[model samples]
Target: MEFRATGADEPANDGRYAWAGTKEGHLFEVDTVELCIVSSRLNVHLSPVVGIYRVGRSMVTLEESGKVLIWGTFDSPDAPQLAGTFKSQRVPDKQNFYAIVGNELWTSSGPVTKPGSSAVSMRSPQIRVYDPTTTGSFSVLPRPMTTPESVGHVGAVTASAIVPSQDHLVYLGHDNGFVSVWDRKTYACLFVQRVSPYMITSLVGVGKNLWAGFRTGLIYVYDVRSEPWTVTKAWKAHKETVLKIVVDPASLWTDETLQVASMGSDMAIHLWDGLLRDDWLDAELNLRQPDFCTFRSIRTLCISWNIDASKPQDLSGTPQNLDFLRDVMLSTESPDIISFGFQEMIDLEDKKLTAKSMLLGKKKGDSKFSDGISSSYRLWHDKLVQAVRLVMPPECPYTVVHVGDMIGLFSCIFVKSSESATLRDVAKITVKTGMGGRHGNKGAILARFVIDDTSLCFINCHLAAGQSHRRQRDHDLVDILEDKSAFSGLGSSSPGAYAPGGDGTTVFDHELCILSGDLNYRIDARRDNVIAASMDGTFETLLPYDQLLKGLATNQTFRLRSFKEPVITFAPTYKYDPGTDSYDSSAKKRIPAWCDRILYRPSDELANSLIPPSGADREDKITPLPQQYRRWEVNVSDHRPISSSFDMQVKSIGAAKRALVWEEIESAWFGVESAMIAEARDYYGGG
Candidate 1:
């Protein structure tokens, strides 16, 4: 059926914004730039609107429900009228109505039936012909007698194309692989061809041949003139069902050029040029597969001949001249021509993963305590407490490694490097409570890294002691463990009991993860007591923490000699006062808690792997004492750097498989990255 034009200015083009009508009879406008829904309204038909096209200032909508509505005014809005309507036994799958050579408006409808539902029976495939200039009615075209009776062959006609030479039409797709052609005027079946048993999903006319894409991942080129429509070329072009195909004639002869682009359920876009004899021979010999070049799905493919004076011969033998073809193909870059539907799915998955990592910091302004005293107060007194916490940026890449009072400034450092041993300061937020106090509010940052595909590394950092402030510290730690806003649900709480300071399920079934940080509470405290006292539990206090950190020798990357005492590498960082010279005097030296530590949770495979014989011995648990303390060093905020090594193993097979799937996912939604980002902004209530 044809729609009468409703007087409406062609949809307002705010650059990338465009309107579309679906087969389900829905009118929607998408922000071409943002890929967001600008507006959507359900029109007349209950089923999806299958095809939409614009002529002059008006839009023509065709619905699968056999109802067509014309709302845009061809001449004026007030003059809008019902253009035409057609009823059919089956819903139309593909529809195209074009003005033929004469004033006659010829319309073609192929087999497109609604999905089977419990309440409705399946519809048979049929084609409808219409003369818009006549009474504006349609009738089912006579079916070819040779058409198969099986549902596979007579179900939905997947595709239809009008031959450029005449009003003749090619209807070559099926729920089965049967392809048939007919003369529109005579209703004569010229040929019937079956290229494969697999269902034909798409059809494209290139030159004198017809290309058919199959659900079985194969493509066949048919010579329509030959009896029974001989198949000229056939190749396996995809790993999954082929969804759509577009032929680019201009790229037919270029070196390793792409003559056709196909998208499939696998989320990959495959590019193909006509196969060379050698390539086909290799495939036949099982020596090589067809040269199926794959691109990220976001890329749309189209053909353009080199029209510039420098390469005029590129247009030879094509139907259109170089300039005209170039104008047609290059008017919209290949990237813009193709569209996809699964971007939302991929984006949803990405958002889900990002949320998993958001719980790495304490909620705003929560107090943290260590030992039985307030670590916040002690750090504030020492001028080491900075702001107690800082909100992480939405897209911050570094995983928070540690956060605590460095002296009195709230200091936090994130593990900036994903490769090896490297920690960098991501942010050092400073908070001023009053004239005398400047505290650093470094939010705890935690990250789970994929170590060579199969393994992950979890790094944690802890800050020095404080009694009553331990509760806040515990809360911060818990926040880090449970936040899902960052990595989108990829992170979880410590796997175990939910008691404060006790370890819960941190990593489950994941290859390997290392949960390390400055767990302030001693490793021997009871979980319930720690929770009641509001004290941050130590490494030995929580069952999982104790099991993971106990017996793991500390890797001290720095050392200090306090009060000129015999070179000492280990000293409690909190007890030293800058004014007392206790750090410089030789008479009395105070030993303090081993506040800085690093732990490694190596899997069995990694634990058994031998350390490289040439590198620094992995046995160095204590860092050598620095020869002298710089100005910042004397107070330099207390904690020393700690480092460790892991014999992380690579799982090549798993990694390769993951890479393949990832490539497909990326390809399937290639151009829609910005759309996905926009969706995220919307989901997060951002503009």
Candidate 2:
């Protein structure tokens, strides 16, 4: 579940404790003194709790079952108790809740319905102004902050935060990327602004503005005083789903930094400082490699401060010795700079890993497409590689790196560095289906490696298409692998391939460690039953590789499409339509499909130590989406990239660790290489 830090300081000689809640309907009192779970009670109902807040000495909790529990102290001497419960009549599913005045609660419910429908349940959230002093019952405020007329078309209120000012209640956030503000006193919507179609996941009030965090890891800050709620700041700071946001007020005053801590489903925590005020400047800064020169990834830069600046200096000139400081300030900013990198693929047969520069392939006239692809890839790759190098350092006991491209091409590049470095390549060696004609022969490099005592393999493969041509693509891929005996004669020796087994066994499978690319075939037409049964592939089919390799898959295979309004404007690679939006009449027609994925197979030791048990998809449960069938609306590519990790120690054995630590490395190898491929199709109007 989720944890929130109370304003209360950590328990010391005093008895103050940090409070935490769970989706399984439990409230936990954690003692900071012992750093242990002091007490936990399952008094609430079984439904997931949306939010918990403090009202004086009492603790308030809102649950998905549409119930609110007001526990904690009602009298001075007595311990906190269940004071009362308030239930909502208009909106039954409590998506979220917040506390204003004591006993008054504001709640929102925008639970995603079934897939393929754009009509979101815009249930106008209610304000229950209660008098806990009396019967402990809440009276629904007659006039909602957002009226039916004003909020009727707006999507559900995904997030809300209390403004810093005590006199006025200003609510600002997204109902599907539409920034809306409401006056808590009159219950009237002041203004509505649509920034992005993606759901607003988190909202934090920073000074006079509110930062709206989106599902795509973008943050937009709106100043309430401005007539139109000016978007003062926006940035792509996180790599995956941004789950939480925390701000430091002290930093605002110091004018040193603006610290924001963002956590995501990628199992990463990122910290961003130095707000880039100009959109063009922010865009430019994001385009360059984050670690180039003195600059570090936003995550590293954020945690560098010792949290305090008055402490005695240390010999290293690091922030570790400074007094703990939470917040910093933002002053001068930098301009937008365009920088690029390369993704290299090493041919084991040739004993070489060549560098491929990350670039965008456009039909020459499109600016948006060019900016989105090149800039987006550069931003993502830079962040990911930097995180890996810093967070999971070589000196750390174990680490694994997983990288993929957004356009449905995937590769699991595994690096095991203890003393030296060894790489592995595992391309598809056999296909399970029939081979048709010349065009039917397709090959995928599942993985590549330098297999010494320490073995590391990189597997890259794109699954079959999702449309009617799926059978052809699927069969062709499998045929190439199946005809391993004839591969030596087909002139399949590209710059990326490893040589045929020099010993002549034709198969390479020992204590093989793995990195894999799986094109999760969401739109394949060949398997009618499979496709119809699960547009997002069945858990069974997706689990085999995970089971066999003893590793975990990183992304939710099936996503509720269009939760966020369209961001990327590329046509689907699998399903092409000449007249449809994703198809450019001037360019070749291409199909639309979501079918790129990544998976990691850990060594047995690593599997037992780090990977969580059960290969089921957990992210899908956290955020559900309504279904919609509009094409080429937002994603750079129809398919999102997937990546997973493994433990280096487990992948290497007793004698191999010392020799594979310092191999020459290229950071953005795979993505850079994919950018050079021929353009698939231009679906957007101009592009």
Candidate 3:
């Protein structure tokens, strides 16, 4: 039951059967589908088995003691019979000492007896190749009989692979992080490149790409075909040392998408897109295929308000006698996307209401309500829908695509009726930072959906209250973003549709992320000065004192620093007397702070598209522009509502045209070399 597989090799071409060697010198036959041991041969070797490989019909097993055993075909009905036994031609450590390429066996040719000044040691910086088909086993080629002196201390060969796209070339990764490419026939070292200071742990060859993993958990891919071999892409693949890397056999030697995966000491395995072809493909379309993909400049209106449990009737009593909801909806001239976020939809200060909310909350699968506990949510939702329909052009209708409610916090998204048909993969999830995640009094509601190929996320949060709770609020916000199960509901969705930290989606996974709610950050200044600034319409002077802005400037871990917020020209929206334009008149007189705010992080494509080339005209820049960040004087709640309108550029790609562009770009970029690589892979049977 505690079997620790030290090495494994899949001999069956169908991938249904595998043979694993363990540290106890035991060998087991594994049924890969059921992942269980089917047969076992105990104490097959005198020492720990380090590597196993299948060459033609022979099963090759290597041990740490330099013992190699060749077995009869495992597909035979009889128990495994030792076909032959031979000593390894090189010093063996634990693993990665041997590899099977075609019908030849590739292993180290080492312990060459190095005479050193201090001590006599033995280690090989070169590999030996053998063809078992020969009557007497013999080296097929000279194969780097010795490493060149100019290469320096290349160290012992740790990992090696035959380049699939160029079968005549062999790649070797060393303990000193030096990578050397060899000409298989001539045994000449073509080049030696030092990739990292740390040891190279794993190497995978896919076409002209060589993916190398390091002891520092970093992964780098090099274009071996380039003149001065350069890293095409590199990323921190894990938090700990990477152990191994492999390419999916199915994707290799074919036009199918190549998947390169890595295993790390952190006990996590990750799969990556080899060569990042899809990303490059999309980038090509965005940059060169103008006829296939066009930009649509759509307006997005975001509003954040803390209603303090006030009903819609309170707005009717305002002096202007105008519909505040209708005015806010129409302020952006019928925005294509409208998001309204409200905090304190149910008065949390009321003990009875809070108790009822805690006792009778929304059940599973209930998207809208928590029984009758939060009636204000229903009223507010209805009022906002009514306002959208009342103000929009009669021909262009709107649809309430989603509504997420958490007793005291609510969020609703409305899109132009015609654009609603483009919405897909809609999902909403809630995170409770209240009472250590036992209650929903303080937390966030996140809604995410894909429009065509782009994904967007809206987060409405009510952070911890009180002037001294800034750290707590920061912790809560980070928790909401890092929550592992936040979007577990999207498991049934397509693969690679969303990737947060792991396999599920997080707030950061979306292309465009909009954050709004009662963030509870205050303007850090004298209460009197803040009030004076608000009264004199000099709120810009007080912007420097805003805690959120301060965090963006000073805090290294502040995640919102990446988001862009429109300049704050309006007065602070918090601590006002209900039904009046007055600051808090209560005993605890709270300072006037901008608690409710809106911020957004645009997609990299959109941001990059906005930048014009050198000497280009300003009008040529396709940028997402933000405007009209202001507050409404509804005077119905302690916090005035803040709103902003963003003119964002969205991509609408034509499939048939995109395919034509893809073919054009791939042909021009990869040229005839790609075709040659495919033919070479097939001839070598590298897959």
Best of the candidates, lDDT: 3
lDDT of each: 0.36, 0.36, 0.70
Two-way TM-score contest, 2 vs 3, winner: 3
Clash count for each candidate, listed in order shown:
97, 69, 0
Candidate 1 residue spans exceeding 4 A from truth: 1-18, 21-25, 34-39, 53-58, 71-125, 131-156, 163-167, 248-259, 274-687
Candidate number with greatest TM-score = 3
Model 3 clash pairs?
none
The reply for model 2, stretches above 4 Å from the true place, is 1-16, 44-48, 73-103, 110-136, 143-152, 165-167, 249-259, 271-687
Q: Model 3 reaches what TM-score against the true structure? A: 0.58
Q: Candidate 2 lDDT (Cα, whole model)?
A: 0.36
TM-score of 1: 0.30
User: Arrange candidates by TM-score, highest first: which order?
Assistant: 3, 2, 1
- Give per-model TM-scores: 0.30, 0.37, 0.58
- How would you encode candidate 3's per-residue C-alpha lDDT over 1-687 as one tens digit per residue? 112222124333245556788899988777667878777778877788877876555567777886766664423333233323433333334334576665566666453455654654444355666665444444445543556766666777778776676678888888876788878777678778765545888888876778888876767667677544544544567777889888775565555446678999999999987657654554455465367766667778888888888777777776542677777887887688999988888889998888778777766786545656557888888888888888888899999988988868889899988999978778888888888778898898898876655567788999988887887877687667643225644523532233222222556545567888999998879989989989998888998988899987765345565466777878889989977789999999898999988887744332211111223222321133445888888777888898888876555657788778778878765654456446545744555
lDDT leaderboard ranking? 3, 2, 1
Q: What is the C-alpha RMSD of each candidate to the true structure, in Å?
A: 27.9, 25.2, 11.8
Estimate the overall C-alpha local distance difference test score of candidate 1: 0.36
